[model samples]
Target: MSFRDEVEDGRGDLRKPFLHTGSWYRMGSRQSSIMGSSQVIRDSSISVLACVLIVALGPIQFGFTSGYSSPTQSALSKDLDLTVSQFSLFGSLSNVGAMVGAIASGQIAEYIGRKGSLMIAAIPNIIGWLAISFARDFSFLYMGRLLEGFGVGIISYTVPVYIAEIAPQNLRGGLGSANQLSVTIGIMLAYLLGLFCSWRVLAVLGILPCLILIPGLFFIPESPRWLAKMGMMDDFEASLQVLRGFDTDITLEVNEIKRSVASTSRRTTIRFADLKVRRYWLPLMIGIGLLVLQQLAGTNGVIFYSTTIFESAGISSSNAATVGVGAIQVFATAVSTWLVDRTGRRILLIVSSFGMALSLLVVAIAFFLKGFVAEDSSLYGIFGILSVVGVVCMIVSFSLGMGPIPWLIMSEILPPKIKGLAGSVATLANWFSSWLITMTAPLLLAWSSGGTFSLYTVVCIFTVAFVAIWVPETKGKTLEEIQHSFR
Candidate 1:
């Protein structure tokens, strides 16, 4: 049977499928107060942008968690009397917590709604930071890090998905890229603040993003697509109207969303066995492949151990250099935000992977040459400087595409019916790979700095090939439209 035929399901008059509820009326009254007609008439983009910015804070918190270890590693290790292995475990435990969180994130978002899930995520992050700040022992510190990672894992999946769902097709790429942009800002803030603040103070500062996010979430509408899928038809239409602008005619768009949802068995639980279907497995493969490759490229390793990397490169002010790298990353991601819609996802990803490969190769070569020269020799110092340059270039390359695009693509390509289960699996794979890379980076670097980066370079090279072969271009497509392309 045709998809449309199956979805119609004897429901006559498709145009009248939705019926208003008392709850939608209540929501409308509140919406009227917040979204005065005068404001909506001007341009609807502002509302969507505001919502994206608010949720973007979650990723800022995510970035702060990722960046926290870099600046505070030395101070925290000394204060807690942690060994190299213990500190590495400390750095990687967030990934462990994130893996657990990733496993549950999809179901939580699916059950509670995206806005509610984010609210749940914020509480743990705030508590996690507080625990880290007041901790007098390693146990508290470890617990706090785990809690923070748990929050980050949820934020990682929900923010991009939320942004993609709300944004207009023309704006989706840029808005989605904002997730990574905010994350870079968070990382930058952590690095910058770490320079001036003690480790405890930095931990305390990490609480601010969630503090802002918790209140901000109440102001935005729940995702319209999620509402539609759950049979909250009236609320879904109202939410979409508010996002698109009260003055905008939303009939065609509303119908499109209805058809998309109706085509699926909305209440049917997707089994692991169902994933064997071409439609289900194809997007799943693309989503999972991108996410796993994103981590295997060793981003967290560079981020978690950036200070140490700079010190090894012979930089006297390694902390300051780490901050500079953070700044550069934020700038690169910002450029990517502007370019994603215009240049397209596949092109940017291919270029990003190649640039990362080249940059890591440079670092590998610099480290290899450094080992052959005397420590005090001119060539040794030059190679050290070269390694620093390579790391910066690698970060810039990564931020431009690999950092943002995978999450964007994952959110875009997956069909709404199976997104929750499949997204969790993909997110779990990402965190697992991250944990492996983060846990082993210190040991790998100590064993052979050149070899560690050489391995990453090889991964980056493979990423280029994977994107060229398997990944699709998702630029300027609606979520429903993108899903159809996979078929």
Candidate 2:
């Protein structure tokens, strides 16, 4: 049975706004209440910025965990005497662990509040890294990867929600983008550092972000919305006050938040049966489709084994090339942040998917040609250069849109009521697809690098069609308007 069909027990409505928790906070009961009150007063952005930066450490650690495998693959495998299959398992195990963590993430965040969920995530990440660092055998290494993946799964959901809940609307998009940007930064850090350190030393270094985040979490106030949701009104007001600065009046924003919370809290838990309606199922399908396709393009396969991919391409400085790709990913993602709002979601996605398809096709063809020429021949060297160029362009294309837009569109399109459950389903699909790609990438490369990427190229081509036909233009429309169009 499929995930959607089998998980239909629908025990309860997800009690939290799992995707973008604070989107409703911007809803006001009266337009004048938003405009005429002293509550309209602006607070210093400093405090909010501080909180975001502190929590951003979580995504950075997440990126570090992901990029860790690529740089350390050779060293770790040699040190532990692991075969190719064993090493692939080591790389893919985190996605399995992350799947477990993602499943539990929403409820955990709901039960304990956003800050608490992050603390919960951080502990496992620390333990996971230490385990990897101290490992003497595959058992420790595998366990560590799983632990790290589990931590990342929770972080994947919680950090963005937490940042959204705290930030003002004006700052929300930019600040939320930080989560992804930090992740790329973290990946680059791993690639750069891996060039010098042993795998063990790199694992130890991975623990540093969480170590700082734990104590830092203590200083930042909890999400006011989460506090309000849990019926801690006094704490909620105080938390909002702290976030807004000491003297900024929060009465207007508070009333709006209370109204939103009251309306939301009264909602009946959604059931899978409700998805029979086109309005519900359509968005859910689009959300899951985008997420799954994002992974099926084999981005993680390339990322997890980038150093090995470079080596196979006959690049002399494969590790350095890996570091270069990581740096390019960071820059490309930053450019994407600027382009997403201005250019709109659908355009970027179409462009991204098409670009990836074109880029992968180049890689596939280059690899195919490499087989025809002698290794020392000039033509073979040209194919090798073409492969590197293709990989770099593919990553740049992915960062431009596919990397961030799927989640953005998912959050924008999913109905608020079923966001918790539906978002989980979508997230699970993404992790599962990632696991499949990462697990098979090494074996596929062993079989035929050209064939492996040719498959991805077809997936990306399908993605371009999917986005163009099925995905709606969500830019410049309210959630209600977007939903209405679906109806």
On TM-score, the candidate that comes out on top is 1
What does candidate 2 score on TM? 0.84
Off by over 4 Å in 1: 1-42
Worst 10-residue lDDT window for candidate 2 reads: 23-32
> Candidate 1's residue-wise lDDT over 195-220, tens digit each?
88999999998999999998887777
Error of 1 at 104 (Å): 0.5
**Clash count of each predicted structure:** 0, 0
Compose the digit string of candidate 2's lDDT tens values, residues 335-420: 98777657777899999999999999999999999999999999998999999899999999999989877876776676645655
The collision pairs in model 1 are none
Position 175, candidate 2: lDDT: 62
Stretches of model 2 off by over 4 angstroms after superposition: 1-45, 224-262, 266-278, 473-487
Cα lDDT, all candidates: 0.87, 0.80
